[model samples]
Target chain A: MRASSRTPLTTRLWAFGVWSVVIFFVLNLLGLIGSVVTSSFATRWLGTWFPAGFTWKWYFAAWDEFQLGDVLWVTFEVVGWVVVISGLLGVPAAYALARREFPGKRFVVLLLLLPLLVPSVTYGIPLATVLYKVGFGGSLVGVILANLVPTVPFVVLVMIPFIEQIDPRIESAARVFGANTFKVFVYVLVPILMPGVLAALLLVLVRTIAMFELTFLVAGPGSQTLVVALYYAVFAAGVRAVQSIDAMAVVYMVTTLIWLIIALRFVNPTQIVARAKRDTSH
Target chain B: MTDRGPTLTQRLRARGLDGVTLLVLPCVLAIIALFIYPFLYGLWLSFQPKDGTTMGNYDRFFREPFLYKTIWTTLKISIPVTILNLLLAVPIAFRVRLMKHQRLLTTILVLPITLGTVLVAEGMLFYFGPQGWFSRTVMALGLMDHAPSITHGYWGVFLSLLITGFPFTFLLTLSYVTGIEPALEQAAATLGAGPAARFREIFLPLLLPGLAITFCLSFVQAYSVLPSAILVGDPANTTRVISIAAYQAAFEDYDYSLASAIAMIMGAVQLVVVAAILGARTLVYRGPVAAAKG
Candidate 1:
């Protein structure tokens, strides 16, 4: 390579600018989160770079005051049900889409995409309206049902690419060995599909937990998720210690961060973005 | 001899194997019952009037100018955020391609998004509030005696949206940038193409479609901002987006019909924007890889 081919000074400066932006972005995020973590533990932090003192009492206060025990339990219940139910319904549909060919298949796929393509509030208000009409609105059932609309399709779409990667001959070979359809799916298919299924379900678990719009719209007095509860804790017409609210935010951050880390183990972040596109558009 | 008719067991197995209805009926039923039915129901409800007149909710929405102001409010925030994300994302995404630890950097960047909008907003309040370090630092620097508040106006909500949106757009752009074969850049370099020239000629064409789609997706995501706007912005209506309007129309006012109408309008605007972007997408030349795959 010729030294004359070196990057020009302006190009070097431009590259420097780009790197600075990256550093700034990282520092900004760390500052935001670090401040919250610090504040949550601070005894008193009034306009200082470092907190005056650190304590753990705010966590206990946030716990008892926010009824976090119940909120966590409800979040788990909602996420668990949505994950399991979407898996049960979605895996088979994905299997069929991966393996079968039939009329109007593209149409069915498009129908599935509708729930995901349209913003949740667009469909959420209507869905909640029907749930309220049916005496299910503001209930845990409504939240679960509402979340399932987007999640089930998500499972089906994410699973489709995974399922398509497996050779169809394996299932056919099982059938040739006198195995029934159920046996082929249970013994032959499940082992091969386990990784994909885990990935899909884990991602679904993360999504359901972080999903705010649908849950917020349908959740009732007794059915508030952690996110909705945190929203109220911050915005509800009452004065509360900032540290306590920050504590609750930390809890949310940790919970979702854990799930997302687990999800990243099985899937590339870009693949997730790509999946969103393929799942929605064609 | 006449061919023997298929037996019941054979018929059942056949149905299980290839019967689309048997295989797909449950999911189809679920989508219809849960998704389609509700959307249609919302549509019907939007049109229904409590006073027994059609279009009443829409009429009321149109009659009150303050109610429809949310459209302008949402667009003002969403458009700028989308533009800012694209501008920052393109440069950062290009630089990231040069980094060896691209995946780790990406993961670190995307970590905040996993926290979701609510936590991010709450964190922003403490970190960017009047008495927060940002304000305090500026005060300490003697720029002003009083600390400036970022968590109580358009700037607060805009920053939150930026925080949430930047990583998403960056991730999408990175994928698209990396999807372009490095061999192309190397070839351009060997041919004496400078960085800018190579990017303009080789990368820009390839990245445009993906960027369009990314912009649309990110814009839609930002446009539907509710929690951040309400949590961090001037709640007196500075950042009162359309979604907030819909929420209030239903829950606070007990006017589900009006709420549904506002939601319908929001959906329409979003759809129009998305459709236009997608339409523009068709005009751009998709490369051989995309074309062959499609």
Candidate 2:
């Protein structure tokens, strides 16, 4: 309050400096993405301020050339299964962790934390190997199982705070009315936790969509998600037109941006910091 | 009415286990089967080389300069990028926390994350390439006589890491910055402490632990730079991070054992860094600090 009404020139200068950096970073980021969008529609982009001409053929070319139809379908299938399964497994675990004082509670918390802490590539290699041994590798099931390693823990972590905010007495009241745990969960807690659940699942959806290393490690030709597919397209850069690749990049951006917008609507980014702080103390 | 024996639910409840407690089972089991088991398997697999002794895989990893140097290459890029991102994020987050348009700014910043690294790398290839807009604009403005190749090298990977890593660091740092009770700073100001003094004495101590955690998380992400390094950087040399080495071993050479070894080394290195940072975090202020209500 008083600080906001500051008279100090140094503090004002500092604020100005910080905002300048923020603006600069955001501008470059926008420009970088804009160039991709611009190039995707360009007839031919050489060394110039603008492309030689603009066109819409890149999108069609990218779709057919990359077999994007199958990729999109696979991406949706993987994200869908990951979101649903993580929610089912994570929400109840979050409830238990939030409300109960059970033995090995610390161990459970640590167990969940490890998957998040370890980089995906580290575990992804071995996980893929295991999946291969079990005959699930390079299949849709392998990708889903690999992705769930991170998402389920993520869901559990994100949902715990939401569950903690709810009153236990609500569950007790339902139980007193002869509602079993399952019934109370479905009828009482679910309604109250709907917003939190949506937020958690949406985040999981966004994360699973962008998740690269794990999916890349486990995905087969048929199981490749949009991000992995984009990687391949970019990797084999010389074979395809630059415009088409850019078009695919734009498509990936739009796909993720749409979900990100929806996810942001339900969740505050700062809450992640709160969760991080809690984990540290634990 | 005849009294019934203690029910299963009641019996389970006596041992601190109930239907609710059992809800954690599915998640825990899933993690164990998927995460813990694979990790253990990887650790075991690392020792069983294709033809040599138990330590052959790890020995081969360390024996070759190309393989062992990736650890250094990964550290070189990741450490600087992580440190730079933290440095940039803290001030911006502090500034953003005071702004009225916090959500708007945060949402804008979070765009890079959802775009994913592949898209970011692709965008970089165009925007920062030799003939891309950046060089063209710079040359047109007489900022330089020749175009600079920012892509296809270390700078490309570094820039991409900064772009993607900064938002995550900023968000975490912003939350921590905002978590500090404003009244404390106000009280400090009332007591004649200037902005610098208040931050140094009050904010920095509280922010340090959170910053350490942020550093660890951001560092881990940067440390595993696979897509961007390959897409933007000279993957065989400058940005041959440990992850790429592991990938090559596994897929390129079809050597799962060696790949698992490289992965284990990578994990070990990351764990050591994380443990050190977290260990150092404890030496700072560990007392209760109020978390501002959202």
Top TM-score hit: 2
Indicate the residue-level lDDT of A173 in model 2. 96
lDDT of 1: 0.84
Candidate 1 per-residue lDDT over residues A1-282, each given as its tens digit: 467367567877888888888888788889889998998999998756788999999999999999999999999999999999999889889888877766678898999888877888888888888999999998999999999998899888988888787888887889899999788878998899888889888878888888899999999878999999999998872588988988998898888888888899987776555563332231
Error of 1 at A67 (Å): 0.9
lDDT per residue as tens, model 2, A88-191: 99999999999888889999999999988888899999999999999999999999999999889888888888788788999899999999977997999999
Output the lDDT of residue A220, model 1.
89
Restricted to chain B, the TM-score per model reads 0.88, 0.94
What local lDDT does model 2 show for residue B175?
A: 77
Fnat for candidate 1 (0 to 1): 0.62
How many clashing pairs per prediction, in order? 0, 0
- Pairs that collide in candidate 1 are none
Checking candidate 2 for backbone clashes, the offending pairs are none
Find the candidate with the highest lDDT and give its number. 2
lDDT of 2 at A278: 38
State the displacement of the C-alpha of residue A249, model 1, in Å, after optimal TM-score superposition.
1.4
Error at B208, model 2, angstroms: 1.7
Each candidate's fnat, listed in order, reads 0.62, 0.81
